[model samples]
Target: MKRAVIGTLLATLAMVAHASTPRDLESSAVVDGTLVLAKNGTVQTVQIKDEARYGKPIADMVRKAALQWLFYPVLREGQPVLAKIDMHVRVVLQKAPDGNYTARIKGATFGDMDAKSTDALSNAESNKRIAPRYPIDAARAGVQGTVYLALRIDRSGHVTDAVAEQVNLANIGPDSALRQFRDEMAKTTLAAARRWTYQVPTTGRLASQDHWTARVPVTYTLNDRGEANPDSVWRTYVPGPYTKAPWSDKSDMDSVDAVVNDDVRTEGAGPALLVSFHQG
Candidate 1:
């Protein structure tokens, strides 16, 4: 369920935290756009919406990679239908020993821009969110990462249960030490999530359901200064092992990771992508 943004460690490592610093200047990046699909699931057109922000080099790599992608055909009442989808692609540039770099598409997620049109899980119009406090141990050690949380909400828009689905660390270290740090970050995130609430869908297919499932990621950065913009660029990170929520049917990993910005992704609300999105 985890996407390894960086293929291989580009630089030598040490047991210390700063030893994990990236030698190459090219950091991980994210690009998003709309993809038009034919009835048979072939990509008819690809648009690079964030080229100016991500730069042409990164945008071109994502565009070429996306053209070769094939998705599961969308169906309406067992009949094939043409569809348009919003896609977010994560790119990582790895420098080889020969001093050359290669762009790899680690993962991509496909869904509809408007969630209300589909019966699948979608976010309500209103919600109250509380940012999690940076753990003292992690902050002191200069640890930074993003924690994706899976939440179960009742019809009343109250969080009934919350779990940390995955934690990706911007810093790297020994496997044992990284796991312990991730746990500390997850603990704090879950505590804050319990106090949050959201508006339930009143018009969609899931509105009448007894409960809804939603996923949102909380990021911790040392230089955020309380005005964090996650979509500007993605920092390299080592993805931790994914923990599935007890109420989840499968590990819906791709949908949540595609959210480069601060937004809640409701389950089952967008067009279903049947094929694997890994391009690396």
Candidate 2:
């Protein structure tokens, strides 16, 4: 059923750190909101904290998921206290072979959780990555966030399978326009991810592992100018047989391409906000 997604307020979430990210299932839905809990720790209800992105569809979804949420009541002096807190929730969207889509909650974050988070975000640093082109639709709409991927790397360092794990957009709403853009953007990311290959470690530290299966995070952020410059780059990779990335032009070995700022280059790529969860 369609639901209203919780919003991101200027407020904060204080979730218990005992519960962390959910590793299984599929669907990409991240949310930000507040929970009003009864003194006994029972959830009274939730309210969307951010400006409404999508009108009715997501709000309804938010309502449904909130009802199923299990929160530990905040206790003080050995008793429950009515509490209001801020949080972020992420859900996974699973696409079957039939191309049908289904959603599942992947993770949620409390603004006041901990200095240490178990959700380890591993951006592929060692592999050569090609930065994806910002989709015209997304760029025009100024959508930006990270895209999480599950990659199966074979012994040869080739990406045997690369799946679009999640999208984490922050500035945009989940309206029909934004949703359409995210869908198109996901396709671009998946295509670029599949073509990635890393140099397999034959000798040094990783000699024991036969194949590496891991999560890769690719972030797509617009340049500070709010425009896709295709030149606003931050990191420069050394040009050579050993360190060249896809976004680099072989002839331009001395300079890193200005493909980012709003661009994400994937050798393996991989934020936060109380409000917009990349793909609402």
Identify the leading candidate in terms of TM-score. 1
Clashing pairs in 1: 120-268, 120-269, 121-268, 121-269
User: Over the stretch 1-280, how does candidate 2's per-residue lDDT look in tens digits?
Assistant: 1212211211111121122323332224345567676765455787765526423455566656665555555555657677665554544455566866555454444432222322222234543547676765455445555555556667766778665544544443324433454566667877877776655444422345665544445666666576643321111111112223332232121112211122222221111222322233
Model 1, span 1-280: residue lDDT tens: 1223221122212235465455533356657799888998888888999588878888877777777778778776778789888887777778788978788776666667664554544444343436688876676566778898989988777899998988888777666667777998899999988877777666645677888888888888875443333434657777777788899785566545666545676776655555565642
Poorly placed runs, candidate 2 (over 4 Å):
1-129, 203-206, 228-280
Off by over 4 Å in 1: 1-15, 20-27, 72-82, 115-129, 203-208, 224-231, 253-256, 278-280
TM-scores for all predictions: 0.76, 0.36
List the global CA lDDT of all models.
Answer: 0.71, 0.45
lDDT top scorer? 1
